[model samples]
Target: MKNIRNFSIIAHIDHGKSTLADRIIQECGAVSERELTKQMMDTMDIEKERGITIKAQSVRLDYVKDGEHYILNLIDTPGHVDFSYEVSKSLASSDGALLIVDAAQGVEAQTIANVYLAMDNNLELIPVINKIDLPAADPIKVAEEIETSIGIDATDAVLVSAKTGVGIRELIDAIVERIPAPSGDPKATTKAIIYDSWFDPYLGALALVRVFDGEIKKNQLVKLMSNNEEHQVLDLMYPHPLKRQKTNAIKSGEIGIVVLGLKDVSIVNVGDTITDAKNPTAEPALKYEPAKPFVFAGLYPIDTDKFEELRDALNKLKLNDSSLSYEPETSIALGFGFRVGFLGMLHMEVIKERLEREFDLDLIATAPSVVYHVYLTNGDMVEVQNPSELPSVSQIEKIEEPYVKATVITPSEYLGNVITLLISKRGMQDKMTYLNEDRVMLEYSLPMNEIVVDFYDKLKSISKGYASFDYEPIDFKEGNLVKLDVKVAGEVVDALSIIVPITSAESRGRALVKNMKEIIPRQLFEVAVQASIGSRVIARETVKSMGKNVTAKCYGGDITRKRKLLEKQKEGKKRMKSIGKVNLPQEAFMSVLKMD
Candidate 1:
């Protein structure tokens, strides 16, 4: 029998996931008053810079009660909707989950999502309605709402102010009581879940696992069940990478790190299951499935000439993150650009930010487009990622659309208004609950097709930024939405358009084109920016004028400063790919591009 337990802390965005982690670590004696960074789990520069958890992080805490210590393995996961797949994978590794619903916000989309994932994994779920110390907190109502909605009794839900460390003791006790201790024969073959994995400059590749069954120690031969690949373990450790926690063995349900320096670290993927080869365990590792990228955009180096460098940078990015999907694609009009796929818009933005921060390379992007299903003749089914590739009316049979399951949380007074807004957006209510007399829960099944353009911005606007929602691809249904393709200089730019509602096509395209105009940097030549509905251009922007004349009259200013200035200008110009006399800038493409 094992005394240790493993649990994950999951919640909606900004629900204090990192904060609660801090208090838990402190209580476990992992850190002292003088030894902790703010949001220690978020150690990555990108994570701290964005104020979000982009990766799943693991930590081990030794909790003492009456002089008896119970080691608890705690893994913190990204709470954003974009990282839902990562959340699901992390949940797969845990025996239970701590659903940290915000007291003031009650349950948002991710709250429902993380809970659903835990239930699906068949893991024990202990709801920790957090932020109780906040003046706006309403733990009682949150518990009631959770019970009424998910059918999980929140009657005993632990209320905690993770920030103030209030009620943390109770929360820890609840974890030990609610979650099952790790089980299975310690002498048998080992099987573990890769909670998180990343590349290390010195160590090569590192994999963090919670041994669900048997034992794994240094010199043990293990196989990844998913790929049927064998690796010889060279070392073993616990928790943080900085420490070399060499252990002879890890028994069933013990969380630890295993290193296999012999194998190519690149193949050791996160979410993979590692098991001992001897006394083979019949049960395979837990399923590892990456989320499909919903948002599509074009990635082009601004220095139009550094195409190879851009590709290499993306390759390096893919090595670190398994989520990014990219394909070699080109625009006859825009020249060379990559069709990069992302889980969502937030994901795209995060990737852009990372590239800018890390690569120091300028990138240009077009607008994001939704995945479209175009039924063709001869019983052929096609998924159109770019609008310019949409089948002509002759080739297309019936078009199907993607949908999202959304949850809306707001004040009771705003309930009617929120529903009205969703109804207008062609969303159907799936479920509802009363958080309190003053707050309500509203669930809706919204079409993903409708949300392809400006739906998120509109949702924030209508709810006055008080509401939070998330969605996953549910099913495809017949819809009236059609693809609007943008054409620049008579050449169709596939990355420049999106699939949107017929009613708002012209208006949305017009507004987007306006945003694109503001975002797209000026070029050496007068370039045209256009948003088109199919082949017809609905909106267009013409560069007003160029400040410089083609003839440089070649002799002015200090020779050295001018030479330095020319060198800098040349280097800057090289960062952007020049297409048809236009030098595209990275800023123009990263956030708001007219291309895909």
Candidate 2:
């Protein structure tokens, strides 16, 4: 175990985490040159196209240092705040981490957040300055910034260009010399932590685990600590870039994949402990806590009959993304659907897109909302995920919405714009500091609801994409909030209902109705798109009826005859308006996101 080094690569979004991972894999000769591609660890097409990492991946490497063979287990993690839970879980499985910082960008909000996470895990950190090949690169300045802001010694920080493969050899040598190897007893009872699990059609569910105590061998019956269930290990393999390398046993201080040949992925939960069923360990290998979802949205199939298919898809997807939670729900506007909980907006988007692309399903996702705490007059409290699920006004006492502590790092020139944007989102200043004369870091407390929709986009736009943001949920606080119900032709569209702060209810209602008017297709009769609170309509917009000239045939008739035909047409429209069902295009449901 002395020659074994396990480490995770972490960084802010677009700070070369994945590229650095690719470079390291190349340097260690994990994959052949003919098979290697960019972002080798990122297997998803969406991740490739978007230039982002949505999932965490691990690979075992063999390296020869000074004529000694060394085993290096490297885990590549996502840099986006939405996938930070993946980073945390990956960190928990590692003994050290490589903190990658952009040479020109210096430190970012997510960098600080990830540093804190590493500190909490007590992992040895090696600061690495990437993008040194760029013309504007400032490795020395970034190293200083890391030491000042992150309070880590950066004098020996590695300077590498992940794109051009500079300093990669030195970085690997630093890892071998500095990061501590895994320490556990190979003779102890079998104990392992399942860091990740996903479904495989041919192999059933596969768990990628780190062995902490004993060894996991083929045909060994193991018990899951999360549940007292026993399953024999059908196969064991070391994770690799192109194909898994078969192994007979996974000894202590090693990471490998265990196949139990079970169809149900839930049984192999991430963070669960696997121990020898006959001589099980006394306790779990690590203390595990499930991920908590912060945002909620409704996902409905366009074809109601495919509801069961959607459920099946969700179950399969849950195996890949365990953070996702869903429950059955029905809406007047939309038929049977599932109310899904997500970690953040990006996560919601990725899941929806993946469902559409991979499962071949047409889905409509309602406006994302945060969980709200509704207290009743009788002193009963209920948690509300869907706005339409809110109790009647008469039964409610007060409403509390979740809040988050947001950290933003931006250049000084955009400080005014950033502050204005935050304040407009009902943010309260918490603290502020200057990372240097030109860059500033601002902290704010903002309602979770405000940031769930388009805050990140706005922040990026106002700052010209020079700022980085990250947030963590703090607690729920009471707020003067109201539910805004949207009505189409006198019928409430429960799917479009949203909870908003009482202060901006009027403007939000107006903007929503206005946006809806543009997206709602014109019907044979006029449709009144109204935003209301209870019985009071706050804003209304009319989607004008499609004109049909009934008097065209009587062009030469008397004026009274033409007038009579027009009157009949008006009466027909009035009758149709009462019963005509509006076919809300998918864009109408998504219009809620564009209501600025």
Among all candidates shown, the one with the greatest TM-score? 2
**Model 1 agreement with the true structure over 142-243: per-residue lDDT tens digits:** 888888767798888898998889999999998888899866667667778776766655776777787877788788888887778888888888885234
Candidate 1, residue 594: how far the Cα is off, in Å: 9.9
Candidate 1 total steric clashes: 19
Clash count of each predicted structure? 19, 0
Which runs in model 1 stand beyond 4 Å of their true positions?
241-244, 262-266, 304-320, 333-337, 430-433, 489-491, 512-531, 534-542, 545-580, 586-596
User: Model 2 off-target regions past 4 Å?
Assistant: 555-561
- After TM-score superposition, the amount by which residue 497's alpha carbon in candidate 2 deviates from its true location, in angstroms, is 0.8
Give the distance in Å from residue 529's predicted Cα in candidate 2 to where it truly belongs: 1.0
| Residue pairs with clashing backbones, model 2 | none
Every model's TM-score: 0.86, 0.98
Best by lDDT: 2
Q: Candidate 2 — worst ten consecutive residues by lDDT sum?
A: 549-558
Instruction: Write model 2 residue lDDT over 183-270, tens digit each, in one string.
Output: 9999999999999988889999999999999899999999998889999999999998798899999999999999999987678888
